[model samples]
Target: MSNFVEFTFRGQPGYSEPTAREVITSSIPVRTIAIYCFDPRAADAAQAVADYFGDEVYPGDLVLDEADRKIGSTATVFPLIVGGGRAADALRSITVSQHLFGIERVVVVHHSFCGATSFTAEGISAAWKHEHHTDISSLYDWDGISIADFEKSLNYDVSLIRNSPGTPKHIEIYGLFYDIGSGELTEVVRDVPAKVA
Candidate 1:
């Protein structure tokens, strides 16, 4: 755990006589819900997002495929350590977070040139079968990972949370496409449901 270093002034309001105290360390501020993002390079991107958004970033992984390493942070709208095309698996976390913190907003951040979209269903099946000596083709759903699939997959993930009976209906969902080369976050807007009269 890291301490927060801050500055303070010891003086009356609008008084010329002002005293400055040395930098003091304090506990980091508690934050609300964060954006759910996925990418192999999500950790680095999450740190950059935290720095850009002026927030402290901590580490947490949505999946435990690796050695308990820091995968992502919940400080700001940034990516979490997640497997490619596996954003739907995070619906439970989203629901739990909202239930606990009363979060009404969630941002799904997917990136361009993702490794998730790099394989076809056949290729993925073959690779998985060879690696694990098991046939997973019949059960696995992600068939093709491509640029076209990015927004579609993101929308599918949003729908999973938004349509879930366990999740509140009023929760607002937003999608962002992060460009890996340019470090830009672009909004992906589909048709928004019309407000009831």
Candidate 2:
């Protein structure tokens, strides 16, 4: 009944969820998901990951249909920008991306001098309570609210993604620390599922 329904795959006649998913999977060449901070200074994080992999394509050209309608892309890396590049906020996206694009790798990049390092979980909670008169200390995991150490944060995030049920067991997960000033990435943690015998 809604006008937007016509824009959705389910709204089309002869629409099948499985068929639509297959089409989407074949259309995009996405093999990696890059999760990084929303900071403007760290915008090149995705490209850096692609370069690190040496086989990925970032910002690849778009493919168009006969009618010039944009349909697909040659990009292999999809960037999922978020605050602090926390895995807590990227779990759902990882799930959906795996469902549709069948990603082979998920990279989490935490940048140097990020705003997330500026405040503690308790500090944010207390500030929210004083300013908005709302208690949110228990609403989120305290450890994920801010970054204390890059190695610890990266390791925690990589473990979180690996342990998530929605994340495919076969996929590789990596945690990297990006230096904003130097434009360099340092691998802090890498979680690759052991190959089955």
Report the poorest 10 consecutive residues by lDDT, candidate 2: 137-146
Candidate 2 TM-score over all chains jointly? 0.98
Q: Write the per-residue lDDT of candidate 1 for residues 85-165, one digit (tens) a residue.
A: 344555677665554445445556677777766767778779888999989877744522333476677777667657777
Residue-level lDDT of model 2, residues 141-186, one tens digit each, is 8887699999999999999999999999999999999999999999
* Alpha-carbon lDDT of model 2: 0.95
Best by TM-score: 2
| Candidate 1 backbone collisions, by pair | 117-145
What lDDT is reached at residue 66 by model 2?
A: 100
Residue 124 in candidate 1 has what lDDT?
73
